[model samples]
Target: MGEPFYITTAISYPNGKPHIGHAYEAIAADVIARFQRAMGRDVRFQTGTDEHGLKMMQKARDLGITPKQLCDGMSSYFIAMCDNLDVSYDVFIRTTEERHHTASQELWRRLEANGDLYLDRYEGWYSVRDEAFYDESELVAGEGGDKLSPQGTPVEWTVEESWFFRLSKYAEPLLKLYAEQPDFIQPDGRRNEVLRFVEGGLRDLSVSRTSFDWGVKVPGSDGHVMYVWVDALTNYITGLGFPDETGDFANYWPANIHLIGKDIVRFHTVYWPAILMSAGLALPRQVFGHGFLLNRGQKESKSLGNVTDPLELAERFGVDPLRYFLMREVAFGQDGSYSPEAIVTRCNAELANSYGNLVQRVLSMIFKNMDGTLETFSSAEADDVLLATVFAACRDELPREFAAMNFSGGIDAWMRGVFACNAYVDEQAPWTLRKTDPDRMRAVLLTLFMAIRDLTIAIAPVVPTSASKVLDQLGIPADERSYAALTGADWYMARVATGEKLGAPVPAFPRLELPEDAA
Candidate 1:
């Protein structure tokens, strides 16, 4: 979080409603951006739609609308999903925007001027579903012996005269970039896969297509539109008002990370860097291809009819609970199953029963017994080794996991703190101590208050709205929500707000059983 950190999610191709997979990437990127901001970093987060694609054109034609009209109608759905998730993207760029067209044309000119573009008759197997081309060897055979892309997306033979980018010439350079910056592609598996693909052989890439008019037009080529990848990938720079890198672009260019889906790893890790190299632009620091979200052990897709509407899930359980389950149930960077069973389990057990119950019980006891005013803490009980260990462990582990983009690990680390607090409350029996040793009871409540305070700050990125409520009940000032507030002075008996009256506490996560409201 020291340097300016810029990150992006692959722009959604706005042909339909965004599924859980789309929300997964957005939430992950948002967590990183929010965490970095909390760490006091200058962070720029970008996400949006890749509206200029063959798919969008087809969808538009099927609807009897122009592609622009289709993009306008569909992009709002993606924007709505981001808003519903509380994604704090600084910019939502659409490739159809004029700025993107300018940036794309500039990139094309740079590649052409640098001798990377050559017009040639192209013939190959292409996957419309994937928006990518595949070589004969890269194709998989189906049960019917039909050719398919490696991901099993069906491929069709296509021939067109197109502009080619000299990707073959940059193979060594791209590999060297990977070797020099070992983290160029992340999650080791993706890095290795990209390396193997490049090592197999480098082929010049088709950079422009004449088949459709729905994409950014190649500079000086009236009949050709830039290939979707070429046009779409530039949105990263275009979002910053690229080709003009004077302000936003100058400050945040060469993004810290491009957080893309695993399916698009090759385009981001391979072709993207090659194109940037031809333009003499610095590569993005990292391209992390996180795994897909599987619903019922199968990928969420329209064809499967299992594509989950993110808004539906959010409506069933409050937005924060939905956010928590996704980051908690799924290990970041690996395929994780999402099922109603898993969601309800995490929502009821972790959020409602465990974490929520702890907060409500502790605050209710203080309110009913002590008039909700915090009293002086006495750390006389050395038996609170468990609670002490929790504070130390969370202070050590939470930031480390968060910085590494392991949302699950970060939340797990915080849950260690949560579970310990719950265990401490039971072991100390604050209610029993309230009558016998009132001083001891005060100390115990104070300890619980401090523990909740620290945890609320730690969890703000994941469950912001609930954490804000928790912080308010703890009498935390608006400005002190950052981790800095948790540091300094023995946190066991915080002098920051001694004898402060806490606001009335409400249940954070209520146990869920499907009702009409959930619909």
Candidate 2:
């Protein structure tokens, strides 16, 4: 087994309901965690909601409810979405939790002790909608000559007393850290952008807010509350038992990766790491900024009234197919548009036609000719080559693609296994051999069976429901369906349990029909 691995998705800000973009990040992190677990490594997968900030306060006011009441309702939706999406998180943390508040306070105290925090009056362009401050250069002219944030949210000038973190002091060290660990931030393009921003200069970031009381209070600072990002980021450590320093925190303080959306890459890659450095803590191993999911060629935003509900999509299409299509549709680090047509095409071509057909045909033939029991066969030259290709694809090419977070490429590689198995079936002509040569027929079916087993293991993380279906047809137990247990082994010993009935194999992804307006 390799060293322990840890990963986390950016805790979703529970200002509103969940959307497809939120589901995408959670699914991506879940896939990585599942893959690492299958590799026989101890894996910690954390996810949760960011329940504090100006946005939450505004939302509470809008709803005519307390902040806690707002969070209680909104956070439950986010949590329910994670459960619906099968996010196998080891811990689901909420920034509003007492433990998280404690951790954030301890981090603030440490930074203060190191002279990295100071009391300051902040007067600048602040976006209550974003809970973020923007530099003069970043503010753009909006309608009626008003200023807008970089995210295009309207900004207003605000003056308040706040606690500030000396982010500018660690700019040089941050650049140095990036220089030392080039892979610390995902996709070369994102890393380059962050580096350019830091190289230009850093500003001391406001770490607390006095205007909003719906947040964790800074230690000994009654009026000031810890900033949302500051409070939320601490959940990564708090979930691991930070400040105690004797439990999971000591083991997984520096998470292997913090998976976040491109919009907040700065918070995770730049601000979060600087905060950790200021507090004399190790930074996370990598911060991956995954691209956004666009709806009908436009970014999904609630204000735009174009937010795509993930549950609605899953209800229309199966969950695994939606999960697979999202990851396979985009290159992972570049924004990609979501279209029903594209999804249906992928499902028909890849899922139904390729992977599904391969499994159905293989099992149907085995059930008919072999009486649902496959006979052992020696590995032929062609079988050896196909198996070797599958092994190389998983061990070498798959890792390289996953390391870069190219989930689409990884899915394509997995499909190659399905393609190879189909090709092997064609070349062997098992249908013809069943009548002409019984021995050769068994060999062909056995080879295809092994290939199916290997393919099931490889694609399990992406399309787990369908993979489970395939494995069930083959009568393999769920516990025995691990990747580590599948590779480079004599699969003849693997038996299909007698009297086991194959589950009904319907189309995993039905064709999506777009409404006329969407069309």
Give the best candidate by TM-score.
1
- Cα error, candidate 1, residue 127 (Å): 1.4
lDDT of each: 0.86, 0.82
lDDT of 2 at 183: 94
- In terms of lDDT, model 2 sits at 0.82
Candidate 1 C-alpha lDDT tens digits along 1-519? 356889999999988888898998999899889888877789999999999878888998999999999999989999999999999999999888898999999999999999999999999999887899889999999999998899998989989999999999988998898899998899999999999999998999987889888888888888899999999999999998889968988888889999999989999999999999889888899999999899878987677778789998888777898889888988889998877667887889888888889899988888888888865555865436655766665566888898888888888888888898898888789989988998888788777777777788888889888888887787777877776666645543454447566666888878877554322
Report the lDDT tens digits of candidate 2 across residue range 270-317: 898888888889889999898888887898766798878898787776
lDDT of 1: 0.86
Candidate 2 TM-score versus the reference = 0.94
**Lowest summed-lDDT stretch of 10 residues in model 2?**
496-505
